[model samples]
Structure formats: structure tokens, C-alpha cells
Target: GSKVVITSVPRVMVEGFLKEYLSVGHVIGTELHTFGCYFTGFLTSSGLVVRHRALDDYFGDRKPDIGIGTSSLYDHLFISSCKVSLNLGPMF
Candidate 1:
């Protein structure tokens, strides 16, 4: 089996930034889907710890599906003027 690992700055920073953004409803246009798994976590100024495991008995032998897509207008002047930097590191 292949494994995927996603690492970022200290958990605290990620949680803080995400929490603040979520509170302000800044996360728009993304669909939230529900999965039959129990996810528990605790958050503090520095970070969060979460644990989630899918139940094997509930859905057996089926591969989990995941996908991501983004939409942007290339013709927009603002889009043409925008700049983004991609950092190949734990923090970006």
C-alpha cells in the first residue's frame, strides 16, 4: 500500500489559522462531505491532535475516494496580475 504524508508548520499555527479563517466564514465555495468516521481532537494556541479511523465493518473492501478541483478565470485582469509562490517545504 502507498502512504501519503502531509506535514506543515507546528500544528498550533495551522489550527490557529484555520480556526480564525473558519470563524470568519472565509472558506467559501468548497463542499463539505460527511464520512462515517469518528474524528476527535483538541486544540490549543500551539496546535491540535486529531484521531480518526474508518470502520472496516461498515464499508468493507471498497477503496476510499478523494478529489480536489479549483476554478479561476484566466481572462480576468486581476488573475493575470496575481502572483503566487510555491514553497517546497513543510511550511508554505
Candidate 2:
């Protein structure tokens, strides 16, 4: 079985949009610190995109066959755990 997990540190609310737009089943993004309807512009916890801890929490008992990343260092935390990894480089 294969799974598409988007491990980013954007915001949890975006998970729904990404799931529908990209058709991915899982999303692991950072939780934004907010007060009422206002955003504090900071993370409630730590960023997930560049942290290996996020990967650990996301894929506890299972491992992905491949990992797609953007950098050699930051993204590699998630990439290195997979059987294979790909660096897509900068989006621009």
C-alpha cells in the first residue's frame, strides 16, 4: 500500500483544501497560533516541515516507500526515512 502524506508547517486548516485540491489523503502541517479570529502569526508548537519529529509522529508504525522533499537538509529529515527520496528543488 502507498500513501501520500504532506508534511508541511503551514497551517492545519489548509489540510482540507490540499486534500481536495491535490487529492492527498493525509496532511501533517503546523498549527498556527491564533486568538479568536486573529492569527498571532506564529506557530502554536514547532514547525513540522523541517522536523524529523513530525515524521515520527505521522508515520509511527508504518514507513513510506518514497519521500518527496524540497531541500537536501531540512526536507531530508522526512526523505531519509523512506526507501527512496526525491528532491523537487525550489518551486520557482
Candidate 3:
């Protein structure tokens, strides 16, 4: 079985929605710290910016068979590190 992991900087709360909507198995998004159920608007200690960290979280020491993303440099970095990569053009 292949696990679909979505990696991006979408709002913390929207991660789950996107995961479900996209029917992906997991999500790696920028997590925001909250206070008393209210967003503090600050990123948590482990923000998913650097691609390797997100990859470590999901893939550990192993790389995925394929990596897909937009044309941004960040995405390029992530996809390049994979065994195979596909660029879907710019997201914005």
C-alpha cells in the first residue's frame, strides 16, 4: 500500500480538512501553536519548512519511491531528494 503524504504550509487547522478532502493518508503542514484553543499565530517548534525534516517524520531513513510537488525551489529540493520526482508546475 502506498501512503500519500501532503507537505505544505497551509494553516494548521486546515491540514486535516485537506488530508480528508484529498483522500491522502497523512499531512505534514506548518503547525501553529495555540493558547486555550485560540491560535497564537506562531509556528510550533517543528515547522515543516525544510523538506528533509518532513521526510524524516514520514520516511525515516528511507526515501519515497516518488516525490511530487510544484515548481518552487522548496518543492524542487524535496523532490530531488527522492528516488523519482515529478514537478506539477507552480502552485501559485
Candidate 4:
């Protein structure tokens, strides 16, 4: 009797392909503030740009502040940024 072996694709390779096919560039900038973390980068191959930010704290998770009056607004901005970046173009 004989047996056969199989191989599977690696996660990193898949992620790399997706990132490149998705036109995601190397993460060039990152900033973390009291409110959240901001990421900035350019899709080098397609010439598209992106800016992303994620809030550190959830709505009503902490004492209200003039700076944090509207958590929904920030959430919207973050979501829009991601959507726009991901759908900006068809990768070659």
C-alpha cells in the first residue's frame, strides 16, 4: 500500500498576495494618541493614498469630554477611510 502527501498555502503568502493585489503599501506611518491610533500609507503601485485611525476607547467607555462628544462620528470616519482605501481601484 502507498500514501500521498498534500501541501497547503501559507497564511503569510496569502496575506502578502492580498495586500499586493489589494494595493496595500508598506505601513509608513503610525501615530498613537490618547484618543486612538492613526495609520498612514500609500499604495505605491497604484499611486493611491490612505489614512486610517482606530479609536482606543469605545463610546461611553470613559468620562465624556469635549474631545469625545461624538463617538459615532469617529467610527464613521474610520469605516469610511477603510472602505475608500480598499475599493479605490482594481489592482493590476
Candidate 5:
């Protein structure tokens, strides 16, 4: 079983959907703005995360074993950095 790291999605949202089979052990995403128990629906000062940069920050000098993402231009750079990548197309 390979480790799955999710980047570029809201941490709260990913946390809810990630399950045991997904093997998602790490995440890099925008931090939420919150007041007490209430969410502001806004990101923290860091703002929205750039997927490729977040991926770089997560792995540092080492590249990830695999990258899986949608078949969109947005994911091109992120997917290219990995040792192997899968573009799951629109259904993804």
C-alpha cells in the first residue's frame, strides 16, 4: 500500500472525505478563517494554495512516488513532478 498525500483542497473538506482505502495520510491546503465555532468561509492569510507549490513544500528535496489528479491544465505541473502520474480524466 502506497501513501497518499492530498494537496490543494480545503483541509476540512478533504478530512471529511478521505477514508481508509484512500490511504490519504497527509494534506496541504488553505487554512480556514474561523471565529470560535463559526467558519468564515474564507481562507487564512495564506490564501488559496497553489497545488504545485504545495506539492513542492510537502516533499521538499524528494519527489513523491506517484501523483494522481484530474486531466486538466491546472494539474499538469503538479503531475509532472512525480516519478509517475495518473490523469484520471473528467470522472475523477
Candidate 6:
């Protein structure tokens, strides 16, 4: 089976929905601050997650098979990196 990964939303926020509804296998989102099994609803020390950087880290040297997103600004960065990309936006 092809691995489906979504890496733009906060993991703690949309992980369940993505998995259940979208059948997403992996999600790389903003890391929330946690203490002893408690979420702080705050970003981690590393700060806000950069989309392009995250994509580079996730893919390394292997370009992804596909990239899909709604945002043109942030999503466009990685979408172009994939072999195939779909921008679900009005402009696209």
C-alpha cells in the first residue's frame, strides 16, 4: 500500500480526523509542548514548524510520490518537490 502522509497541520489537532476520514498514514505537524502526559496547547521550544523545512526533513533525498494541499503559498513549496502534486485551491 502507498504510504499517505500529511505534514502541514498540527498533529495533536487533526491527526485523528486525517486518519479516520482521509486515511492518512502519517502526519508531521507542529510539535505541541507537553509535560507529563499533558498538552500545553503551546508550541515546542523549536517554535513554529516551517513547511518547506519539514518537507525536506520528511523526504530527505527521496522526493515524495505526491503532494496535496490547499494553501498556495506554503503548500506550493513542497508540492513542487513531489513527482506529482495537486493544489486544491481556487486559483489552481
| Residue 34 local lDDT, model 5 | 95
Report model 1's TM-score to 2 decimal places: 0.20
RMSD of each: 15.9, 2.7, 2.5, 20.4, 2.2, 2.6
lDDT of 6 by residue, 1-92 (tens): 45656464567898888788988787778888998899988888877777778878877998888887766677878788889988898565
Which portions of model 6 miss their true places by more than 4 Å? Answer: 1-4, 21-23, 35-37
TM-score, candidate number 4: 0.18
What is the Cα-based lDDT of residue 53 in candidate 1? 17
Clashing pairs in model 1? Answer: 11-47, 12-46, 12-47
- Per-residue lDDT tens digits for candidate 4, residues 1-92, read 11111112222334455456655433222222222443233222323212222122222233212121123443334334321212222231
Candidate 2 stretches greater than 4 Å from native:
1-4, 46-50, 90-92
Q: What are the per-residue Cα lDDT tens digits for candidate 5 across 1-92? A: 44656566678878656645565666567778999998888889998888888877777878888888888887888899899999999767
> What are the Cα lDDT values of the candidates?
0.27, 0.70, 0.73, 0.28, 0.77, 0.77
Order of models, best lDDT first: 5, 6, 3, 2, 4, 1
Superposed on all Cα atoms, model 4 deviates from the true structure by an RMSD in Å of 20.4
Give the range of the ten consecutive residues with the poorest summed lDDT in model 2.
1-10
Candidate 2: C-alpha RMSD to true structure equals: 2.7
Model 1 clash number: 3
Which parts of model 4 are misplaced by more than 4 Å? Answer: 1-14, 27-77, 80-92
Ranked by TM-score, the better of candidates 1 and 4 is: 1
User: Model 3, residue 6: displacement in angstroms?
Assistant: 4.3
lDDT of 3 by residue, 37-89 (tens): 88887878876456656786678778888888889887887888788999998
Q: Tell me the spans in candidate 5 whose CA falls farther than 4 Å from its real position.
A: 1-4, 19-21
Clashes of each: 3, 0, 0, 0, 0, 0
TM-score of each: 0.20, 0.71, 0.71, 0.18, 0.81, 0.75
